[model samples]
Structure formats: C-alpha cells, structure tokens
Target chain A: MHALQQKIREEGIVLSEQVLKVDAFLNHQIDPQLMHAIGAEFARRFEGTGVTKIVTLEASGIAPAVMTGLIMGVPVIFARKHASLTLTEHLLVAEVYSFTKQHNSMVAISPRHLGADDHVLIIDDFLANGRAAQALISIIQQAGATLAGLGIVIEKSFQAGRAELDAQGYRVESLARVSSLASGRVTFLD
Target chain B: MHALQQKIREEGIVLSEQVLKVDAFLNHQIDPQLMHAIGAEFARRFEGTGVTKIVTLEASGIAPAVMTGLIMGVPVIFARKHASLTLTEHLLVAEVYSFTKQHNSMVAISPRHLGADDHVLIIDDFLANGRAAQALISIIQQAGATLAGLGIVIEKSFQAGRAELDAQGYRVESLARVSSLASGRVTFLD
Candidate 1:
C-alpha cells in the first residue's frame, strides 16, 4: 500500500481537480511488481471472505483483477463493456456511466460464468462516482451471487462514491484514498 | 501447452466453420491457473529474447499478458481500444479490424510506454486473419521497438493469419493451432 501511495505521488499525473492519472504505473502502462503487490494486499484484506470469483469491468480493471485472481487462486470474470457476437448468453446487464469516457455503456456478464453458488469480489482501477462498482454489484445480485467485498486501487474520496456505496450496505476497500484533488495536488485521506 | 490443447478440446465450443469460442476458460471467465501456465509456456518460448515489455491489446489480452509479465519479471502495456479522458497522450494509433466484432477500431498506445530501446513480446487470446497482430506490429514499428516474438493462445492455421505474419518476418508461437473448424468440429494441426 505504501508502494502504491508513493508511486501515485511520484508518477501519478494530476491534470485537473477531478482527474488523477496513474497511467505511468497503474493503468495504461502497468508495473507488474506493483500489480502483484496490490493483488497480494487485496488478498490479505479479503482472505477468508469466501470469494469464489474475481469480477471486474473490462480494459483498465482487468489487470488488477487478474493479478488478484492469480494471487488468490480464483477465477476472474470481466464483465464486457460491449456485448460481442460471442457473448450472446449475457445473463445480467447493467448500465454504467463513466466519468473518464463521459458516456454510459451497458456492462454484461454471462450466466455460465457466475451463478447463485458463487461469491464475487469486485475489483476496479479507480472509484470516482462508483458507477462501475454499482454496475458489477447489480450484476452480482442479478445472478443470485453474494458480494463478498469490493477492492479498488484508487478512491477519490472527495467524490461521494465511498459514502454512497457504504450507505447501500456494501463494504469497499481501497489501496489509496484521496481526500482532496484540489489545485492539481493529491491529498490522501487519513 | 498440452493442458491448453486439452482445455480447448474439452471447453472450447466451435460455433461455426470459422469461430471457436473458448470463453469458458480463456477470455470471459478466466482460469488463473491455466493462464499462469500459458504465461509460463510463453516465457519458456521466449526465454532468452530479453523482452523488456509484454505488449497487448486490451479487453481480452490483459490476462495472459499480465501473467506473462509477472512470470518474466517485466512490465505489460496494453493498447487502449478507446481513448478515455486520461488517454489524451495517444502517441501512436493503429487501425485494427476485428473479425468477431465486424468493424475496425483505432488502438492506441502511449509513447511513454514503448521506445526504440525496448524489446516487446506481443500476447493475445486468438490469432485469425492477423489483423490485430499486424496492427500491433505497426505500433511497434512506429515506436521503433524490437519485436521479440508473438505468443498466441490459439491460432487458426486454416486462416491466412500465420502466413501473413510469417511473410512479414515476424516470429510467432501459438499454444494450440487449429487446422480446421468445419461443421462444429475442431481439427488441430500436428
């Protein structure tokens, strides 16, 4: 966790009051060592939670999720942002709005992957408005699966994502939480 | 590689004469153990190549690429399919035609990730008409990086992908090579 917070301070580029880009290490270009550490940390936090699957959104979330799955010795099911031709048996679909992309898209999961017997741990790169996490939670519930917990790499606590998710009775764990992203500076939450 | 072949024979679904869906274990819902084996197989194949980075296209390619990067103790950089807000520095873009999606999309990689001094191993889930491989090659060439090799989980040898890439002087290694996929039957090339 220290490595992550340190890396964010060193390599993370804050372009605006609302955006913190850790593209140098976390997303886009990834450091596998850091990813493994992040995964290990997540596993440590949610070790005996009876997690059956590591579920995440596609693209950015795939890396940490896969890494966590590897470390936890579980399977990772990434909900597709776009339903491809092969993903015809999409059992559950939830619409999510992305602050980064500035658009809403339907995220779906195949029934073959998740079911009532499974307990899922949600993983993502960042938590801003918590739209992505909410979508995954929706899919998990729709499949009759249990939401073990949510693991996020970075959480912009200045936003209401954590409060909103907590109010809804979902437990969320983030490696780094930012209390404020004001004046292009990242202030960590104590 | 044998386990991969066995997994294909067992879980892989041949939908059409040209389509083989291994979504059960390869893509959508991933088996991390199998992925680690696939990564280890790739690492074995490209052991002495001095691959500085594992490069891939996002959404599906992240798992195997990340696994390989972890095993090889290197970094992984996946090209972004869509340019998000933070992906403003898309230094290089390549047009890749998806045979499954039936459309061409621009794949971009940040220049900060790859350079002339880096040695890259291209990893992907499938290789059919070689369009994705070609696009990655173009991106690599643009960045002036060295291509160590191409590691594919499955290759449709019946298609022209291998031929095209071979003609272009790129070394490729596929775990399972399907010689044919006719009438929902998968025939592998010995």
Candidate 2:
C-alpha cells in the first residue's frame, strides 16, 4: 500500500481538481511488481472473507483482479463492456455511466459463470463516482451471489463512491486513498 | 502446455468452423492457476530474449500479460482501444479491426511508456486473424522498440495469423495450437 501511494505521488498527474492520471504505472501502462503487491495486499485485507469469486470490469481491472484471484485461489470474472460473439447467452446485465469518458455502456456477465453459492469480491483499478462498482454489484446481485466486499487500488475519496457504498452497508477497502487532487497535487487520506 | 490443451478440449466450446469459445476459462471468466501456468510457460519460452517489457491489448490480454510481466520482472503496457481523458499526449497509434466484434478500433499507447531501448514481448489471449498483434507490432515499431516475439495463449493454426507472422520472420510461441473447429469439436495441432 505504501508503494502504491508512493508511486501515485511520484508519477500520478493531477489534471484538475477532479482528474488524476496514473497512466505511467497504472491505467495505460502497468507496473507488474506494483500489481503483485496490490494483489497480495488485497488478499491480506480480505483474508477469511469466504471469497469464492473475483468480479471486475474489463480492461484496467483484469490485471489486479487476476492477481488477486491467483493469490486467493479463486476464479475471476470480468464484465464485458461490449457485446462479443462468444458472450451471448444467460447474461446478467447492467448499464454503467462513465463520468470520465462521459458515456454509458452495458456491462454484462454470463449467469453461467456466477451462481447463488458464490461469494463474490469485486475489484477494480480506480473508484471515482462508483458507477462501475455499482454496475458490478448489480450483476452480482442478479446472479444471486453473496457480496464479499469491494477492493480498490486507487480511490478518489473526494468522490461519493465510498460514501454511497458505505451507506449501503458494503465493506470497501482501498489501498491508496486520495483525499484531494487540488492545485495539481495529490493528497492522501491519512 | 498439456494442461492448457486439456482445458481447451474440455471447456472450450466450438461454435463453428472458425469460432471456438473458451469463455468458461480464458475469455470471459479467467482461471488464475491456468493463467499462472501460461505466464510461466511464456516466461520459459521467451527466456533470455531480453524482454524488457510485455505489451498487450486491454480486456482479455491483461491477465496473461501481467502474469508474464510478473515472472519476467518487467513492465507491461496495454494499448487502449478507446480514447481516455488521462491518455492524451505523444501517443503511438494504430487501427485494429476485430474480426470477432466486426469493428475497427484505434489502439494507442503513450510514448512515455515505450522507448527505443525496450525489447517488447507481445502477449494476447487469441491469435485468430492477427490484426491485433499487427497493430501492437506497429505501435512498438513506431516507438523504435525491439520486438522479442509473440506469445499467444491459443493460436488457430487453420487461420492466416500464424502464417503471416511466420512469413514476417517473427518468433511466435503459442501454448495451445488448434488445428480445426469443425462439427462443434476442437482439434488440436500436435
């Protein structure tokens, strides 16, 4: 966690009061060691939580989720942003609005992958407005699976993502919490 | 590699003469241990190739790429299929046509992540038409980076992807090679 926070402070670019770019090590390009550390940290944090499956959104979340899945000895299911020829049956679907990209996309997972007996842990790269997390949660619910918790790499604490999830009685664990991105700088939460 | 071949034969769904869906493990829901084995296999095959970085496309490729990157102790760079707010400067771009999705998407990577001194190993989930590999190769060339080889999880030998890359004199290592997918059955190339 310290390493991630350090990496964010060293390489994270603050575009504005609301935007932080971590494309150097995360987002676009990934630091494998950092991801491994993140996976271990998530495994350590969520230890003994009965996590049967790891769920995430496609692209950015795959690396961390797979790493966590590897350490936790669980299968990882990534929700597809677009419809694929291979994925066209028994889908649990949800609509996600990306505040960053400013577009709404459908996120779906096949019900065949998830079931009522599974305890699903949702993992992702960034938690800003929590729209993506909410979408994954909805899909998990649709499958009649139990929610283990939500794990995040970097969280924008200034956003309503954490607060909303907390109000819903869902446990949210973020490795790096950014308190603010004011004046082209990153401020971590304690 | 035998394990991978076994998984394909058991869980892989042969949709048609051209399409074989491994969404049960490789595409949609990922088996972490199998990916670990794959990453180790790729690392073993591409060992001593001076692979400074692992390059892959987003969504499906991230799991294997990150695992290989972890074992090889290098950075992993994933090209973005869509434009992002955080990624907008000095990008090396290429257009990739997805035969499966029936669409063209621009794949871009930041110049900051790749350089002339880097030896990039391209990794992907599937090597069907090889358009995605070609796009990544183009992006790597634009950065003046050296390519180590292509590491594919599954390669359709019946397709032109392997032949084209072979004709180009590029090294390719696929864990599992499929000879055909006829009559709803997957036949592997020995």
Candidate 3:
C-alpha cells in the first residue's frame, strides 16, 4: 500500500481541478512489478474470503484483476464493454455510464462463467462515480453469486462513489484514497 | 505448451466453422494459473531478447501481457482501443480491422511510454488475419522502437496472419497453432 501511495505521489499527474491522471504507470503504461505487488496486497487483504472469481471491467481493470487472480489462485472474469461476435448467447448484462467518456455502455459476461456457487471479488483501476463497479455488482447479483468484497487501486474519496457503494452494503477497500485535490496537490483521507 | 494444448482440447468451444471460442479459460473468464504458465512459457521463449517492455492491445491482451511482464520484470504498455480523458496529447496510433467485430478500430499509445531504446514483445490473445499485430508493429515502428518478437496465445494457421507477419520478417511464436477448424474439429499444426 505504501509503495502504491508513493508511486501515486511520484508519478500521478493532476489535470484541471478534479482529474488525477495515472496513465503513465497505472492505466495505459503499466508497471508490472508494481502491479504484482498491488495484487499481492489485495490477496493479503482478502486472505480468507473464499473468493472464487475476480470480476472487473474491460480495458483498464484487466491487468490488476489478472494479477490479483494470479496471486490468489482464482479465475478472473472481466465484463466486455462491447459484445463481439464471439460472445456467448447467454449473458449477464448491465448498463453503465462513464463520466470520463460521457457515454453509456453495456458490460457483459457469459452466464456459464458465473453462477450461484461463485464468490466474486470486484477489482478496478479507478473508482470515481462508482457506476462501473455497480454495473459489475449488478451482473454478479443477476448470476446469483456472492459478493466477497471490492478492491480498488485508486479511489477518489471526495467523490460520492464510496458513500454510494457503502449505502448499498458492499465492503470496499482501496489502496489509495484521495480526500481532495486542490491546486494540483492531493490530500489523502486519514 | 502441452498444458496449453490440453486446455484448448478440453475447454475450447467451436462456435462456428471458423470461430473457436476459448472464453471459458482464455479471454472472458481467465484461468490465472494457466495464464501464469503461458506467461512463463513466453518469458522462457524470449529469454535473451533484452525486452525492455511488453506491448499489447487492450481488453483481451492485457492479461497475458501483464502476466508475461511480471515474469520478465518489465513494464507492460497496452494500446487503448477507446479514447479516454487520461490519454496524452501526443501518441503513436494505428488502425486495425477486427475480423470478429467486423469493424475497423484505432489503437493508440502515449508516445512517452515507448521510445527508440526500448525493445518490445507484442502479446495478444489471437492472431487471425494479422491486422491487429500489423497495427501494433506500425506503432512500434513509428516510435522507432525495436521489435523483439511477437507472442500469441492461439494462432489460426489456416488464416494468412502468420504468413503476412513472416513476410514482414517479424519473428512470431504461438503456444498453440490450429491448422484447421473445419466441421468443429481442431487440428494443430506441427
């Protein structure tokens, strides 16, 4: 966690008044060593939760989710943002709105991959408005699976994402939580 | 490679006469143990290439690329298929046509992530028509980076992907190469 926090301090860039860009190391260009460490940390945090599968959204979340799955020795299932021709017919689908992209998109998973017997841990790179996480949770619920917990790499605490998810009764854990970003400076939540 | 071949034999589904769906363990729902094994195999194969970074396209490619990067102790930079607020201004972009989706999409990477000194190993889930791989190669060339090799999980030998890449003088290695998938039966190339 300290390592992630340090990386955030060193590499994270503040854009405008609200956006924190971590594409240099976390999203676009990934630091695999740091990813492995973060995965191990998540595995350690959720040590005995009986997690059967790791769920995440496509694109950014795949790396850390796969890393966590590798460390925890569980299967990682990512919801596809777009339904390709190869996608299965029976699927659990949920619509999510992206504040960054300003578009509504559907994330889907094969019904055959998740079921009532599975316990899922949702992972993502960033937790902003919590729309993406909620969408994944919806898919998990539709599949009748247990929600072990949610693991996020970087969370914007100033946003209502945490409160919204907490109100929904989902336990959320984030490596780094930013309380505020003022004048290009980040303040962490105590 | 035997382990991968066995996995393909067991879980892979023949969706159509041309489509082989391994979504259960490869792309949609990932088996982390098998991914690690595949990553280790890739690392072993590209042992002395001095690969400074692992390059991959997003969504499906992120998992295996990150896994290989972790094993090789290098950074993994994935090309973005969709535009986002976090993407940098200057980028290396390429257009690739998807055989599965039946559409052409642009993939981009921040120029800051790649450079002339970097030797990159391009990783992907499938190599069908070689369009995606060709796009990636174009991006690397634009950055003046060295192409160490290309690593693919599954190669459709019946297609012209391998031949096109080989014609371009790029070294490609796939764990499983399918010679044919006619009538829902998969035959591996020797």
Candidate 4:
C-alpha cells in the first residue's frame, strides 16, 4: 500500500478537480512490478475468504484483476462490455452506468462459468462512483454467489462511492484513498 | 504448454468447423492457474529478449498481456478501444477491422506511454485473421518503437493470419496452433 501511495505521489497527474491520470502505471500503461505488488497485497488482505473467482469489468480493471487472480490462484471472470458473436445466450447480465463515459452499458458473464456455490472477490482499478463495482456485485448476487469483498487500487474518498457501498453492507478496501484535490494537490485520507 | 493443450482438449468447446472456444479458461471465464502457467511459458520463450514493454489490444488480450508483463517484469500498455474524455489528445491510433463484430474500430494509445527507444512485445488471446495484431504492429511502428515479437495463446493454422505475419517478416510464436477443428475434434499443427 505504501508503494502504491508513493507511486501515486510520484507519477500520478491531476488534470482537473475530478480527474486523476495514472496512465503511466495504473491503468492505460501498467507497471507490472507495481501491479504484482498490488496483487500480493490484495491476496494478503483477503487471505482466507475462500475466494473461488475474481470478477471485474473489461478494459482497465483486467490488468490488476488478472494479477490478483494469478496471485490468489483463482479464475478471473471479466464481464464483457459488448456481447460478441462468440458469447452464448445464457448469461448473467447487469447494466452499469459509467460516470466517466457518461452512458449506460451492460456487463455480462456466461451462466455456465458462475454458479451458486462460488465465492467472488470484485477487483477494479478505481472506485469513483462505485457503479462498476455495484454492477459486478449485482451479477454475483444474481448468480447466488457470496461476495468476499471489493478490492480497489485507487479510491476517491471525496466521492460517495465508499459510503454507498458501506450502506449496502459491503466491505471495501482501497490501497490509496484520495480525500481532496485542493489547490492542484492530492491529499490522502487518514 | 502441455497443460494448456490438455485444458483445451478437456474444457474447450469446438464451436464449428473452424472456431474453437476456450472461454471456459481463456476468453470468457479465465482459469488463472492456467493463465499463470501460460504467462510463465511466454516469459520463458521470450526470456532475454530485452522486452521493455508488453503491448496488447483491449478486451480479451488484456489478461494474457498483463500476465506476460508480470512474469517478464515490464510495463504493459493496452490500446484503448474507445477514446474517453480522460485520454490525452496526443495518441498513436490505428484502424482495426473486427471480423466478429463486423466493423472497423479504432484503437489508440497515448504517445506518452510509447516511444522510439522502447522494445515492445505484442501479446493477444487469439490469432485468426490477424487484423488486430497488424493494427497493433502498425501503431508500434508509427511510434518508432522496436517490435520485439508477437506472442499468441491460440493460433488457427487454417487461417491466413500466420502467413500474413510471416509475409511481414514477424517472428510470431503461438503456444497452441490448431490445424483443424472438424466435427468437434481439434488437431494440433506439428
């Protein structure tokens, strides 16, 4: 967590009050060494929850989720944003709204992959509005699976995402939580 | 590689005369254990290549690319399918024709992430028509970066993908090459 926090301080760029660009190491251009450390940290945090599967959304979350899955020795099921021709009809689908994209999209997983007996750990790169995490949680619930917890790399604590998830009775753990972006500086939550 | 071959034999579904679906482990529902092994195999194959970075397209390719990046201890840069508002204006863009989606989509990478001095290894899940791989290669070339090599998890030998890459003088390595998928039977290329 300290390493991630240090990386955030060194490489992270704040474009605006709401935008934190970590493309250099977090999302677009990933730092595998840092990701491996982050994955190990998640595995350590959720050491004994019987996490059978790791769930995440497509695009950005895939990198960290794959690393976490590799460390946890669990299969990672990424919910596809677009249903391709190869995807079957029987699937657990959930609609999510992206605050960044400003649109609604559906994330889906084949029903055959998930079952009632599985325990899932939801992982994502950032938890801004918590829409993506909620959508994944919805899919897990629909599959009759138990939610182990949510692991996030960077979280915007100023946003209502944490409170919303807490209100829903879900445990959320974040490596770095940004409390404020005042005067073009990032302040971490204590 | 034998483990992956066996996984394909057991869990892979032969969709048609030409299409083999490994969604149970590769695409839709990923087996992290197998992916880690596959990642290790890729790392072993590309070891000492001075691979500075692992580049891949969005969606399915992200997982294997990340795994390879983790094993090789390099950064992984994934081209974005859609340009969100968060993306920077300076980018290396390429047009990729998706046969499955029946459309041409533009993939972009921030110019800040890739440079002329970088050695890039392209990784992907499947190699069929090879349009996506070509698009990625073009992007890397446009950035003036060195193309380390192309690594693929599954390659359909019946398709023209390998031939096209070979024509372009690329050292393409596929973990499993399928000669045919006729009547729900998979035959590997020797």
Best by TM-score: 2
Any runs in candidate 1 off by more than 4 Å, and if so which?
none
Clashes of each: 0, 0, 0, 0
Instruction: Write model 2 residue lDDT over B100-151, tens digit each, in one string.
Output: 8898989999999899999999999999999999999999999999999999
Residue A169 accuracy (lDDT) in model 3: 90
Model 4 per-residue lDDT tens digits across residues B1-190: 6787888999988888767888888787887777778788899999999999999988788888888888898889999998997895888999999877789999999889899999999999999999999999999999999998999999998998999999989889899999999878989896
Ranking by lDDT: 2, 3, 1, 4
- Across B14-109, the per-residue lDDT of candidate 1 in tens digits comes to 989989998898779988889889999999999998999989988788889988998999989998887888888647999999889999999999
Docking class of 4: high
TM-score of chain A taken by itself, candidate 1: 0.97
lDDT tens string, model 3, A1-190? 7889889889999885679999888889999889889899999999999999999988888888988999899999999998889894978999999988889999999989999999999999999899999999999999999999999999999888999999989889999998888889877895
Per-prediction fnat values? 0.88, 0.94, 0.94, 0.89
| Per-residue C-alpha lDDT of model 2 across residues A17-62, encoded as one tens digit per residue | 9999988888889998889899999999999999999999988999
Poorest 10 consecutive residues by lDDT, candidate 2 chain B: B82-91
Candidate 3: global Cα-lDDT? 0.91
> What is the C-alpha local distance difference test score of candidate 2?
0.93
Candidate 2 regions off by >4 Å? none
Q: Which candidate tops lDDT?
A: 2
TM-score of chain A of each: 0.97, 0.99, 0.98, 0.97
- Candidates 1 onward: DockQ, in order: 0.86, 0.91, 0.89, 0.82
Q: How accurate is candidate 1 locally (lDDT)?
A: 0.90
